[model samples]
Target: MSTNKDTMPTALLLGATGAVGKALLKDVLQNGKYAQVVTIGRREATVDEGIPQDKLVQKVVDFENLNAHREAFRGVNDVFCCLGTTRADAGSAENFKRIDQGYVLESAKIIAEENPAPEGEQLSPVHFLYCSSANANKNALFLYPQSKGETEEGIRQTGFQRVSIFRPGFLEIETARSKPRWAEGLALSIFPPVNRFFNLHMSVPVTDVAKAMLTVAQKKENAAKGEEETTLTGSKAAVFSAKIIDELAARPLTQSSDEVLVVRNPYPEPRSFKVKTTAPKQYCVRPNAGRIEPNSKVEVHVILQPFKEEPPADFKCKDKFLVQTAIIKPEYESLSISEMWARVESEEKESIRQQKIKCVFQVPPEQIHHETKSEQSTLDNNNVVVNDVLSETPTATPVPVPLSPVPQRQQQQPAKQDLNDQLVRELNHAQDKITQLQKQLLVKNEQLERDENGFRARSQANGPSRKLPPTVQPQDAVHHHLAALETQRVTEGYPPQVVLIVAALVFVVTYLFF
Candidate 1:
């Protein structure tokens, strides 16, 4: 933990605002190896993690519109992606996928691609460590699992040169975070045994999970290794493969002298993490103590690694480790309209930030259209339409002219009226530009499609052309389409070339691993 700052590997923490991520931030920042630490979070935490205020990079992003943000990922060395949202919080399964699945994959893809080797003197590629769910599967029966699985698969396929996926279980809620829609405490008590028979699954403490992930990522090389290790790591990996998990659901560690057992939560208690460090010098710790709101309960239990080579039958604390997972729930089940308004308002801020690049390129184009398009504004007043049009305008052009100035004496009313008129003009000009760009994009796409049709017709006529790889045509189209989009976005100002390059890189990296 006392490593020098110069020795630290730069890590980008994507979900640093979360309880687990917050833990990682503390450990990573305090350890002193932190050459640099950057975070992309939904909202600003009231209390800053120890990282310098400037070091903490926050982005208000609509998990849904991740595609528009690939550029913002530039220069990130390693990415710690722990971004997630539940269906209840999101209001529907579809919304959950948009955040959990879509945001996760899109963020991974960009991180894999855009991360440049940290530069200054030395050169090293970026690392990617993701916090995935235990039951993640693209084709699972449940919505959450299915999205998580798909997200995992997508990340694996994306070419992040170095990627590590951490799948912690439901958790041993030991933090004090509040959630609006978590299962009621009574319901959790009534829930039946899960992961009991399953050799691979287990709930874990959030703090331990965070610490372990930080430990692995701090190694630097974890991301560089080409092979994908699809399991929990650090202390968790050790506990998942330990014997004590079966001996005691809540207690898993035994001291060297065999005198004491370390359990997370003692009997007859909920929302608390207890440590019974009896004999043999076992450590008594509430790992999640440094991480979350105090009200959260930790319910993690595990059946660890299968018995291997003949050694001691006794549970050994020295050989095993695990973490404390936190569960953050709000105070209510359903969001009131006002709450929804707040949620939407909060969600919109992120939507705007991500849309900045979108508008920069997507709107600037004459084809996207400056007029006759949707004059959309969010409830938060994000002028989606005008921004799009104005964004696309080539910087070469000055803004549309303003109206006559307000005269003195009638200053108050006239100035107000004048300001309103000027805004109208700006909005009009933006709309027109957007329309022009939209039309151009439409025409370009159509032309490309027609060219493909022509090529197909020719291939059909020649027969031999069909021998060319089917992948070739599509690949060409994709390349062409993507290139055009890139160029168009640049011209319109939706995406910078840096962003597109990063996106492509993510795809390549993920593809290699998958």
Candidate 2:
């Protein structure tokens, strides 16, 4: 098979001597998609007879000292790690951990550290495919599963761009091994009939496991390059169960048109999101809606339904996708994705944010030159047609159309309505108090005038013989009482403007109504 050198990917495989690793080696070597396959182990791997070894590179390196052999991981786009051992076979729990967890994690670290981008440039994260056991939990009581779970976690921490952890239940090894596992053999013999009758996925063929890893890796690489959609989901670090692995292996290797769209929430608050594609009949999106926490992201898988006939080379994708997102309130956070979206639609429709992305289909590189020549010919024909049209209308010229700017979502008005309402209430209360104060002042003025009139009459009748006691002016006493009331109202937390307005109102009433 002739492979395109420029488009082919390189793979770095670990544990090539193991059963699953051997099958993986055979698949990658014959797949025609990988340009190079590098296998690193404690000793050189033995290739089967009649299998080509031109693209295969084997490195004998000490797993404990992977730093010394960093070159083996350089320039590799994907890594397949099938390294693991049972505690009984490894002789002790510590040995099992050392081999399964320590070595596997170290290898991942070396791959990440060795494959650095050149200065001032960036590179996509390497896709890592791991073969982990089923029911692996970091808090597992058994050492085997515990080590496997802990190792999976360690690999995640190693910063590989994309990670796929395959958890096969009971692998049916076709090739004979140096040490036979009686329990595994018995389970393998029993699971097929049991699974066939009960519709369970408790076992998988070794070749299928290898095939599943290759399929995922291929899908991931193609999805990155916009050639195919991603088959995996959940997180950047995805886990595949036995059933999923079987399903993935059953998928054909060619003519897949899957794409992965990523939705990220940069806002500090959590967000609810929904995805919809234009061609719902032709395409299906996984996790059409969900909630994303602050500073997190979710991947939406777009799967294209199979076509009956291939489109021509000039096929352009007319499909589009819309991503709808909204900031989630604490109450809506607890709601299901559908319920949350429904609530948002009914309650806060304007808060929903939407982004539309156009779909782009990439043609094969071999057709690029032909497609370019065809495009040039079309452009020439269009220019000739345009010249003819312009000659017919000598004085007319095409006017450039100005595109309207996209309207931005208006900012929510500041939440000062309540505050303004409270201010209005206070102002009304202050005005009523001022009216009451005005009435009291008028009554006092009337009493003071009466007393003054009486004093004047008495003084006149007594012929200036009666000594006037220390006389108090009614106006001065009224002014002092009003000033004291103003000070008291000011001290009671009324704003200066309110106090001033009250005083001005009282003075106006005293001048007019009095």
Candidate 3:
């Protein structure tokens, strides 16, 4: 349910500094529906995480003694409570409850008793959004689950009639900031892929969890005002349902697909009618150049499937692929889930490489992000900050723009707010790479210098004017980089170069036989 434009639901997000809470915050902010957001925690949050300061109501409070700030909960509606304390984090069992159970219950009491709205302006009934663990049963003896179960029960008892609970099975992802244990993340990733076979455990992505939370928050705020949403939807496989699971367990693989002699066509009299194997054909991705970096987006047009008598449902292809950061660089590459942009192309039709499609994906350097911040800060130093309508813009532009024209900042901003923090890290990494490459190259160059010093020294001193690698002797560096780039273009998606490389090896062996 979409909230009314003028009066979006105002939310009080407790446990606002947690992994799940931070995730929920990003999605909520991205959704852009909430009218106001107040994030509170045991302490004031810092810029240690790249979260911009403007968004949060950072507070450091003793949840054990929240009496001083009890009035703060006055008009808050849609309370998202992710507050918790691990045994280790709290130091003792009693300490843990004070944060997880005591802290939460106290907050609930304030929300229920402290109805803080101005005269004649009624506040929305608070909907408590909670995060819980699986197997959180009231009868459980384990301390963690027991306390969690108690918190869930406590919220139910609170007068805030509407309650929403999210008991994610196992949070299946990691943060860019921390090094989560490998085994936990591995189990989450590997188990979900074969859900039909594995019935015991399932996991949902953090994105999906955040999405569900936002969905229910919207429903409670905008739907039948007092409606309580108990509908659970995540990680339930079609085969896991008793009836469906039983049916699948009793059946054989033969039920899935049928093989028929797809009619030897009637129109031909050309002796032999060899049909192409309908095994979903082949796919390929050809990037225009070596690396798609920032400021430049590659144009990638899609190739249409053949008009041959309408293909079966299994054969139909759709353009669906995600841009993945290369293991080395975060530059985006287009990937089709069906395999590649060429999945439904001519190769599958017994036609040789005739389909070409084009679509554009943008790549910009990290500097662009760098210079914009400088521009904004420049406005401050130059007093570009304004008043009236739209406010003041900083008069001075700190970073210089080139006359020939290129994006201002050409750097990728580390999720951290300060540009200085990431510059050292990325620059250090770049320097390490440069040193390693140059070290090895130096040994080779030294031997050559012993043969001829003047020419090699001149090349090194001139820097970019150095001669090209012998393998690419004829082509200029720009053309060489472009050629090297093209050969590996869709390497992120398809197998054109790989197949050629493999074929080349085979051909070499065959020639030796001859």
Candidate 4:
């Protein structure tokens, strides 16, 4: 499953409106890696923040009718099932099970069966990622944990090529609560400082769970690209514990940079690099041209001098200037690259910092239209006239009119005559063909009757004295013979009656016209 680098992946999201689900949706959109994000929920879904509408498709569907929307699962690369519910929210244990276990399992089953791997691929095309509780156990006495464990089993049994189950502890959501829980609030307040010291797998942030899921998906995708192995520590599915989840979430947004400057080599091989920039005219790169060894580091110094031109009143130069860098390879042309962002700011004194650019935004130009008016002056009969008189007076120049080659009447008369003549010829030809077919049919019918009668007479005369070979009865033979005659006549052309009627119509038309 080596995928094209330019091809963006598509993801299907369940429980998009939930806390972790919302965070996951934002990360998927903001990462700009997914080409399409399909969110399915019982009601219409909306993003809390703005995102690319082209990449997001919201499908409002009834969970009870999952089968009806089975086609939606086709061609999906990753399924993020964040659907969950509490017994209180669902009003009963049965309802909670229906949401947590039933819906999740059914969706996974459909996705596994519908989304098949590409031709010649061994693994299932879709990867299943489920969010389960840390305490989830199939034999657990509690219904909630039991339901979550059942869902985990159900997803694994669906036979997805790769499955990543996240068993996160209690999630801390910053948004307004739909239902207040005193125990969750007390834990959130007390667990942050002491949880790390005691190694307690208590509460975790909603965002960390979302980030962990994305990290797993990206890892699997990279594995498919042959950048890494599919198996993680001898297991196909990587189940992240609470501590692992926190570490992943706490990871730096980008590669660490030096206090003053930073440089990164995304390519596999070491290459010579140079830095260039436009505007401000104060930034300078020391030893701009240098070779960066493979899997190594390079430190460069950037000096910022005083600006020559005064800054605009509203200008914010924090992240304004474009820093262009290029890589020089032997026997190959130099290529410009902008994989990192550099910002020079005056904080008490001038300073420069660089970090990898995660996302790029391009603002389109605004559209506006301007209207123009033209005025013309005309002189009529030695008196000047403005726009008003120009409309009343005729122009001196004559306008030419197109003329037809023939008059309308004459053109139509010849066309009508030609049509009538063509019709007459067709009618005559048809009548002749029909008459010939009818005569042939009658001859064949007569011959068939005579043969039948002779055969019957012979059978009667022979009686029991001579035994004759088995043959069709006289009535059946006559019926078959007549059927053959009718088929031949129809295959030849129009029937006799049809030809006669057409001929009579043509005669009447000609008589009336002439």
Candidate 5:
């Protein structure tokens, strides 16, 4: 896509106090392309010395109540978000999630919905640029990356016209902070050297990240302007790796002349290439022609001549460098550089491959402080108007909106009430989950208590048996013998007594018979 050079857009910046955020603020102010730079934060940002404050409109608001500060977000064309916090800094995972995930997402929603276009202008697509971490995945086991991923996912769903997520690797923060981060410092000390030596895109300076973001936004804006030369590659929801960020942020340095270009051969056949530039007077290409073995790469040095006068601010050099490559053929194998190119141009045109890289100039950081008196006055007046509305009270809270699996913004009919209703429904759903968990816990506790009681009852019932020795009998088992006396009386005393009884009985029987 091509970008318009004439459009000067307003930009809304969040988290200006952070390392990358601070760098972004600096770059945005110095670029001089943004018509206005609105900053929203909890406290006043500590602007650096020499940074122009004219374009800056800082608002101190309650981030917790972002609704109250909706005006701060109005009329912005781009959003640069660097709002994030560590679990340790936030004091807990929940707090981290609230700040990293909740705040980031809610802010996106507020800006996307509440922010309206300037009067008399149609609402243009709002480009969202987020600073996310490398390896950020919603399904990640760790909280930090997971939260970042979730935040990125959520912001995409907020209906922004374009969503660019920058996943920078280990950041080397140069800005001063209240507390030092030992982990980052350690990594910065150990990883960068290895990263460079191996050409691993595992570490990047925070400033580079800021510049990369600006580059992307600039490219997108330029595309909007219909600049035929601008070729903004990537998806609507683009993900930039550290390497891509560095590449996009490439700019000529005033102090350095040497830059490296890497040419690689992906095919199994040997390849020959020649490098040429439109700015031959300003740049020198070393070993202008080279051959690369199959599956190998060669680094070419591009030396820039010192500028007699510094280029104008926001200057984009029209000069370009082109690399032409072709497979090595035996027919032109021994030909001189010019002859080989001539032969290839005439015969092997179909096999010739070309790539072009345009030259970009870095805007001086001090440009912000060097504005003309009248321009400075105009910016100051604008800042005054913007400052008049700054307040300490927080206003907007994210009214719940339906989240779609696809990257589509849900319709916000009657915006306010629908958001509130959706949020209430989500809250109710969460409450139901909590209630179900509580009931299950209660059931488990009751079952545990019943099991305990049954165990105790069984223990008590078998207590005596458990206490008795296995070999011992009870006292009821003892027996006694008492047969002797009864037997003697019946056998001896029965002679007289029994005979008298028998005779009496016989006489009675005879009398009765007669």
Candidate 6:
């Protein structure tokens, strides 16, 4: 579908701090399709540096008090809900429900009620986009999946006109916290290679999930405008599986030159392809009908011709085109059915087999340069006003003016002061270290004293018959007595020489400071 560049939609982002939610926030801000993005989280959203704050609105809110902030949901065109948490993070299964199910459902209901589209409109202004888990079932034994399933059901019952739910398996989060779960790490390591064999739902990256959600929302909006049918196939509530999410996340191959477009066949078998354009005169594709070999790509060189000799001032030219590829299988005729019905069924299958890719290119006029210049001028005026305000403000103390360089003597004074400060810091650090060591020494001395006292008491209790052990020689006894005496003396106080050194250092520091 062609995007109306002139019309910029506004979006609201919930759970904007999670891995998937952060990805979505970045994409929404960078896409340029949205004029404003409102992020509601328990705290302010962490946005990347240099991203235009003009387009971002951050609202700190408590999920439990969502009704008080009901106005945040008003007038939003798309609501991307990535709010969820694990049972462990939530502390209990009940709290997990309060967030994953309760918060999500409540927010959806409020958005639907507050941001309803005009009467008779085909689509509501608020398109509820949700992030759900794979294999989520209300009857599941696991608390996490069951909570997600109940949340999905609750969202559907809220009666939103457009609701898209994405069920991705284990997400490979890039920005996860440091504490690692061995099970999750093991699964992430083992899941990718065997994912396709297991229906491609084992694991996916957080960024892909984010991309899929945004892409599906944009496609649904386009479909509502009658631009084209949405690639998503479902009833009012569209559900995208992991495989579909991966496909939606994949970017279509485009040539370096704007005029040329490239299409690749990732499958291991050769496939027939076709290319068609709505404006044949504007674009010509070479080798439009052909077959691509297994694991090979077809480069359809699109030659764009000038639309007019002298284009009008308001001439905005855009074209929509389609590229289709198909793989045929001859063994499907074994099904039990009438020959006529079989033929019709085979034809239907073949028709559906062809994968169609739509591409749009637009050439807008050159009036954007003037608009940028005018915006720059307005910014300059605002800066001037700010500077004027700052100039008018009075200061009690005179501001220090920066001079070219200080005289050599003046520089020497600061250098001495720096040395003095460094010495003071070093002295303090040394004193702290000495104090810590002294405390440890005191603890050890007390322990030694207690042991000696216990030994003496035991000897006294046994009377004169309990003599020193045979192994305890006279020299050993003398060494033990000396060690105890030394320990007692050290514990009493510092030595005289050490005291004198510390006093000398203190005197020098005081003299320097004065």
Model 2 TM-score, all chains together:
0.45
- Minimal lDDT window, size 10, model 3: 239-248
Q: Which candidate would rank higher by lDDT, 4 or 5? A: 5
How many residue pairs clash (N, CA or C atoms closer than 3 angstroms) in each of the candidate models, in the order given?
Answer: 88, 3, 40, 0, 12, 0
Clashing pairs in 6: none
RMSD per candidate (Å) reads: 35.4, 25.3, 31.9, 33.7, 29.1, 32.5
Question: Which is superior by lDDT, 3 or 5?
Answer: 5
Model 4 C-alpha lDDT per residue in residues 106-220, reported as the tens digit of each score: 8887887787656786557677788888667676898988888778767766776677677676677868677787877888777665544543436667776677677667654
Candidate 5 lDDT (Cα, 0 to 1):
0.61
Model 6: per-residue Cα lDDT over 1-514, one tens digit each: 8767458678999999888898899988887788789999898878888766678999998899999999988888888999988877888988889888888888888888787667887445567788887767676799988888788768766766666677777777776555677788888778776653432335777777776677656644122331111111111111122111001100111212223333444345544556667778666768666655654555556555543233322333344544433442344334322342345445743232222233322112133333442100000000000101100000011112222332443455787799999999999999999999999999989977786676666656667554654444578665367435533233568888999999999999999997
Best-performing candidate as measured by lDDT: 2
Query: Which parts of model 5 are misplaced by more than 4 Å?
Result: 1-7, 116-124, 221-514
Q: What lDDT does the true structure give each of the candidates?
A: 0.47, 0.62, 0.47, 0.55, 0.61, 0.58
Q: What TM-score does structure 1 among the candidates reach?
A: 0.41
Order of the predicted models by lDDT, top scorer first: 2, 5, 6, 4, 1, 3
Local accuracy of candidate 1 as per-residue lDDT tens digits, 295-314: 22233222223222212212
User: Which portions of model 1 miss their true places by more than 4 Å?
Assistant: 1-7, 48-55, 62-71, 116-124, 180-201, 221-224, 233-238, 241-514
Stretches of model 2 off by over 4 angstroms after superposition: 1-6, 117-124, 221-514
